[model samples]
Target: MASAVLYGPLFLQLPADLVLYLCREHLRPASAAALSLTCKSLFVLVFAGTRPGFNGGTQRRDLQLLLEKDLGHAPLPRRRVLLGSGFSIGYRSVRLAMNRHFLGAPNGLPLRYFDVQGISLGPLRWFEKWSARILQGELFLSARRTMCGSAWTDEALRAALDHEGPRYDICGHVSMSGPWSISNVTALHSAAVSASTSARAPVVLVPCRDLVEACGRCLTDYTTTVERRVRPVQGGGVDGRQTMEYWFITITSFHRLGSGRSPWDAKWQAFGGRPSISTIRLRRDMETHPPGAVKAAWDEGEQAAVSGHRRSHSSPTWRAC
Candidate 1:
């Protein structure tokens, strides 16, 4: 009776064809499905949890659960297979949030919004230097993801992290990891290569070509990524050691800001202003720019369609949507 009354004629008459078309059109995405998933999942979670008379804090808790438990923060296959499932590759939710707060605190108090050094927060937090945030905070820049914003909760940081960082695989593609900064990945690879007692082929990230300097007025950043792969020659080298050839391979990517208080206000979409939901939309829009490398690292198989548009921060072009 409740179902019939609630989802009555209005629900039935909702045009299944239109819904099917929308689902088919949207769900057919191949790359950076994370971005799409972020928006859709967040909407569903928030909407479902925040409905009228629903538990007030349930939404935040649900998002936190999504951050800590579901995504594994930075999941790894080795841990799952060897250490069993739910093993911690890294629990990055808090670290990402702290980093976001530091980056986003344009007008924040010292310890209130950010205090990685614990100069204002605590001695231990200061001692740790917030290394996790530093790793996930600033790297993985592209046109779609910006350098900074004013959101630093678990879910919001997860959404931002989804846009930043290059995705990587583990265990010969048996498992997956990432949305990690290229620089961080490169540094780790370099360290492993240096410290290795045995000769192992490690995947190293570097620029395949010169950085394409299309900064797009400081909004759309462009970068490239090339992986350093080593192959051993079956034949021996001069000293009976294996001769290796270095191959540079490429990775593909397909992946924010703002305030708008009054609907008509010109600076509505700009960040750090009166809060508006469109501000969230604008930031999300900014984060959609194929949020990974460009050119040499991602040249093959044509480019993905650039979806959504951002209101330019510059005065000449930014305008009401």
Candidate 2:
């Protein structure tokens, strides 16, 4: 009898759809679906409607506010991952609020938002999977950024790379860890070579510095072991400083080859095609040219420089022509 009176007024005053939407939104979860089945109007309104808006956008402003409003002043977010020098990585504590907002929950509850120095593989995979599922949908970038990290175990990284469903290309950052330096030149060289052979190789972004001087510290350090191993073979019999420069140049050339450019092109030509900065100037016309081009150019330059040096040395005794 009471149910009849409540539903009867809804029938008289409200549109069928609106009545159904109210029922769906307000009804207990178990019965909500049943109420929708009673009429199609409610089903569309409840299931297909735009997200119900929370009062203000501030609803998702992380737990910091919760502590401030409910508790008291709290400590600020901390730097989680410090990557030596001026570079560092940290977590954003505000995401807890954002997630709450997404769920349409009441905001201002203090929740765990930031995880510093913690590389969460589960969350990363979930983000990647969902982003691809949405295809230019919301939360795509947030999901990706959440996955980005400075410290990575190679095994975990390989799993990420093998995940063919979605590709974030984790190798670039993996190379940046304290490990994988140029000291282990052979392994470094082989990795570069393998990357070139792959259909789509990862682009290795290295910081620019003096080639020879850079390799000295690189060679002596365990973290930079890859650079040392690779440099010696590529640089040949040159002195330590020269060898460093030679290795740096060789690595640069290898990177270019993997970038889908011809290995034989002149340095200047390749530079124009490749993405390079204005400040980067090659010492020789083709020092950073790909392996094939560098080898050929080196041969020609060697003959010329050596011949000139010999002529200059012997010319001290000869009269002017």
Candidate 3:
């Protein structure tokens, strides 16, 4: 009714011959959508040429015409690296023009908002339809550890994360490879070397974002890294006649890749895909989390070197996503 009053019968009676000269040329997708809402007459005027037989009748035809154009997208995108792998050397990629169509819009507005410049924003009842069109499905993220060089594609890891469980309910286990004495993966703890090792510590992964937040963006997946050389151990006096000490390295670094756009316009490509820059660097983002309940523990009375190989005290230089 408001649109009827705003547009009135007079403007709707414009001659079909004069409509071409009166309408603005090259209207943008969003602006075109907004203009179509003045009334049934204007909706037809704007989208009449979009389809072969779009009679400009019924609301179904109007919706089909609106969807023919591209909408929300990233502008500049940072390269996405699946941890333990290098950037895809060559892949085709393109960035959409605007970033406010699908997903969350600017000003937190709903998708497909059609309001005149100064007019009210339509009835509250249409919110459900608007909400349904917000997200562009779900973007999947997954983490993994490779033996030497992990150049797994985005599709492979995405499939793995989905196989683990439903979205957001993913838990993964990583094992350590080392001398027989300390092969078990141990959680990182602040406890001194003197702490008892009677009970095995549960390596609890502190989430960067809690369950609710991590699950928010449809961005939940799992992968791992092998810190084979990173055994965080300290010397303790001989205990139980042990000749050497052994230890487990806690997982301190986490990263993911595939199926999403970075802050820049770059899309996450699969292995052998596109790369924004040929030269790449995976700098460590020293992310620390609160201590888990499992108290810190370590083995006692061992050589500085384990199995003739010296332990590396430095953290893995993997890139943080």
Candidate 4:
């Protein structure tokens, strides 16, 4: 009786096909899910025919192709996967967000894809250290002065910037087993060489200031000859000191050769064939900018500099004339 009343002339006013089209084209995933739960008739109309491998012939095939192209792959079978409901849409949204945040693309699609290997000293641990440093209030005044300009002299901005550094307990160093420590230049070079031979993708090594300086000192001492480039920028520091910082990066890529070379030979040759090595030297006073603006500016500047460098040095080596 209830079904007859619900599906009578009122529901029949709109064609079933039109309703399905509107849901598919106009509604968000969450809204579509909610609409499906409204009544049995709607649920059958939307999802009943679209079960995995259940073919609606040409229409189903087209939809599958579109989804694969957009989302990269089809959702895994429900019983086989641990993800909850709406996994496909959720994954797509997260990927889009990450791409926008990191790559700064409006559509969140990558221009090119590559397999990149990175060696870092535990990203999470590094982030914790950075957060601790930021909260110390040492850079607050400088940040306010830079961002607010004349407004920084006003009482409000002055009050916001003026504060004492917080104290926290420090952890004792535990010499634990790790693949490679940032302090060891030899280990870093060895890892880069291994990555080059194992994969054709470029290898990126991120080390602390101490390790970077150590590598700079030992650049000529390495068994394999390594090329070096220095880019320096000046900025004001939290302690009111003007400092110049340099970025030291080593990029390794594989090349086709007539015969296989020894590990040492391979490492040296990795740096020879590359056209231009991309590196970034961030100014120390970046914290002075407004929230999110610093990162955006840095990314834009880095991309422009890298593109210009590549265009100017398209030859076999990046050395200056």
Q: What is the TM-score of each candidate against the true structure?
A: 0.19, 0.20, 0.22, 0.19
Error of 2 at 244 (Å): 3.6
lDDT of 1 by residue, 1-321 (tens): 677677653434347555434444664222122222455543343234543222355444443433332222332222111011111121132233333345453221122212222111211111111111112222111111111112233334333323433332211111112333222222123453345434564333223543332222112223334334445556875567675434332222121111111223222222222335753343322243333332222332122212212233334757798
Off by over 4 Å in 2: 1-97, 100-137, 140-321
Candidate topping TM-score? 3
Poorest 10 consecutive residues by lDDT, candidate 3: 123-132
| Deviation from native of the Cα of residue 83 in model 3, angstroms | 12
Candidate 4 — which residues are off by over 4 angstroms? 1-15, 24-39, 47-294, 297-321
**What CA RMSD would you report for each candidate?**
21.2, 24.5, 22.2, 22.5
lDDT of 1: 0.29
- Output the better candidate (1/3) by TM-score: 3
Candidate 2: tens digits of C-alpha lDDT, residues 196-269: 55456443323233222111110011112222122323555435343322122122111111111122233212
Taken over the whole model, the C-alpha lDDT of each candidate is 0.29, 0.30, 0.28, 0.30
Considering summed lDDT, which 10 consecutive residues are worst modelled in model 1? Answer: 122-131
TM-score-superior candidate, 3 or 4: 3
Question: What residue pairs are clashing in model 4?
Answer: none
lDDT of 3 by residue, 38-67 (tens): 677777776676732323444344444344
Question: Please, what are the lDDT tens digits per residue for candidate 4 over residues 203-298?
Answer: 332232211111221111111122223333356555655643332223111111111112122212221222223211211122343223323333
